[model samples]
Target: MDGDFWAPPPDVSPPVPGVSEGYPGVSQVMSHGYFQHGGVTFPGLLYSPRSLEAAREFPVEDDDVFNVTYQKSGTVWMLEILSLIRQDGDPRWCRSVPNWDRGPWLETLLGLRRARANARPRIISSHLPVHMFPKSFFGSKAKVIYTVRDPKDVLVSLFHFARIFRPYRDPGSLGDFMDKFLQGDVPFGSWFQHVRGWLQLRGRENFFWISYEELQQDLRGSVQRLCSFLCHPLSPAALDAVVTNASFAAMSHNPMSNFSLSPGFILDQNRGPFLRKGISGDWRNHLSPEQSRRFDLVYRERMEGPPKNPSGDTKIPPGPPKNPSGVPKSGEDPQGTPKNGGDP
Candidate 1:
């Protein structure tokens, strides 16, 4: 991963040796998992274990498959749902495949093309910024399901995740982390840009938006709605099985779905399990009233009107910033980057 993928403090060095290098436009060294392009850094593969020529090349098929979401937003749950749908609700079959293999992130899938070619009804996941997807897949028959969370929860989740997985000397407090997130210093670019870029495509036939909270509240209904969009419906018994398999308690314990041991795949050796609490409103426990208000202000300004592709989960819409710039007026970090290392 590119060291520049993260905006570490000035004193911290790159996490993985030889994985980063100085770029002219970029102020610091970039990591292997991220690449700098046009002054913007993107999450991508820096190298493949196998020859690119020998990698599997699957056909897009013009069928109704999907590009899933960015991380920390119920991605695991969505993957399980996709697996169940593809298996037609066979509990045993769903249990057979690991989450990584079944719904691999697009960047990770590049080296595993051979394994991907054989997977039927291909379900690909991504944390690719909305603007970086393969152009061919955008308007074609393939479908897209973009899932967005309340930015507060996203920042909280990402903070904890970075402490465990990302290469940093320290993970700052919620207040400090929020400062970077607001400044578009977080990985995958600005949260507003991510949402706005996709919402721009709302109402398109191949696009669908879902929320993590709604899926948590109504698994069966969410699955049915997703099936309806794909023109695939599960039999009554199959639906029941999918719901049971997707239960939080069940998935939390399932090795395939749970990301406890997944650190070895892409993260540093000492990082924490991928799935932390898997609960909503975690921010309430960490974000103070003042901090919450600040976040609310930013959210209101960034999302002025109702989401262009509003899912039942989100209640807030976009609005003008409390501050015209959508950021605090002063007394904030002028660096506009995250302080690296430690727990938040």
Candidate 2:
């Protein structure tokens, strides 16, 4: 079993957009259970167990583990990879666990059983900040495979999510979501900080860093690399099963894999399905040219080069603006500023 998932790192100086506290109808509304960064309303609180009573200390077996990332990034894809690795690349096993509950996110399963000892060797998933991770998960024994995606895509996905999930009912369009994301008001904290914290833990044998774009570009290669990192020897049969089930076609339609169903633990799904479009570069459809440029500038300024795969071997140049607060200027319309320059 894996140890308690930790919290993501603190936003060094999270952005706080100068949004009018609340729109007339939608102001003061909470989205995804948290207050909008500059919006008027605050989200409700989550009811955590507070404590896992004598949760069995997860044994450090073979010193390999998987810490899947939060939503939006290719989590489902990676989940299938981990499941295949743990199940010795069995398609039958992949079908058994399904995609949504793939091995990495075991902390969520704690609610299923009373004691941790009864739990299987877990490949768990979580969105907890790096700071909040249990101390036991560090070092060589427990590996954390962190998968990150471009923030532009993440913002777009979150926007659609707010629309579908109705978490806070954002009256502001995708522009507003972009503003909030750059501002760092969402649930798991700033995306930059999340990547930064995990990257900081790099160089250790236990850390395996991969990117969504790279995975999308080379699915099987990525899977093979992941399996190698996890020390799981893959047979041709096992590899075939993992590749087949982890495809977008396979996962997008499958209810069990899609995570569309409310698992009771997560709430506020009346707005939209958790798994929206699982494609990369979807932000291009949402962000206007001008807005996309602004996003690009901000991304280059804040998150330049992510760590390379498996090894976490890369040079992270000490950059400026830990939080960057890259939200648009006051009175600027995020939904593509009008040519005449008035808020759309």
Candidate 3:
């Protein structure tokens, strides 16, 4: 396994270094099993050894559309947008099922089954890095839309999110959380590595990149571009509907879009909303100047592939070739492998 794929936090002592098979000491904070695989530890609540194994072998379809992101980087928002486009701007159909059901996480234990049972041309989502996806994914014509947010903002949003779990207690001060985040101690591992890994595959025919900042700043344009990439272009009126339906305010209130309604599944409703303050740069309110400077130094050193833009414009150049048909071409499996799938 590549070193970049492993995420071992410095503060939390992992089990004996050589013990690679069982769950590590359970995290008191989240009350979830923490397991180590290939020397990398991840929360068992979302990923288990079985699920990981399943994901590595998961079958992928040519029409499969994956909305990939690190947690809290507008996964739900992109999901809603894709759902609407798939439904041809029919909000009723999009809301007919829970958002989770519409676009299930691909790495969770049951994610693959749920995604497979859904209507043809599934819109699946995952937090797994590019390399972590099943080998079939790389060879298939499946489309992947990876979303990224400024790490500073991701840290702040994740900090508040962790506090919501009863077992997690308060996340201490922002400074403490910032330190852990900078060190890749948080859930999904190093933000730098995650982004860099995916960014490295930017020019692939089936890969598309979008930034949360860009989506927030120009949702209509972003949605239009996204729809085109998915080969599900919409009319001006339909595009308007998608933008309206996917707005933060609308989704925050919708039970389907907000995880708060799920109760024990993920959110502790009493804590707060999952769609908390969707804007970028909110990190300024929490991270001190010194903390920000330190994070910047590390980010510059680690985040090497994509160029950073203040306005969040990380759009790839247009006119990349598209898969003629979702079907297997040559030397590809008729039915791609299935993988364990889920979000952080």
- By lDDT, who's the top model here? 3
Top TM-score model: 3
* Residue-level lDDT tens digits of model 2 in 47-70: 122321111223344443555575
Cα deviation of 187 in candidate 2 (Å)? 1.0
Which segments of model 1 are wrong by more than 4 Å? 1-35, 42-59, 109-116, 167-170, 263-272, 305-344
Order of candidate numbers by lDDT, starting with the best: 3, 1, 2
State the TM-score for model 1: 0.72
Judged by whole-model lDDT over C-alpha atoms, candidate 1 comes out at 0.57
Order of candidate numbers by TM-score, starting with the best: 3, 1, 2
| Model 1 worst lDDT window (10 residues) | 1-10
What's the distance in Å from true for residue 322, model 2? 21
Query: Model 2 Cα RMSD, Å?
Result: 13.4
Cα lDDT listed for each candidate: 0.57, 0.53, 0.66
CA shift of 242, model 3, Å: 0.6
- For each candidate in turn, the TM-score is 0.72, 0.68, 0.78
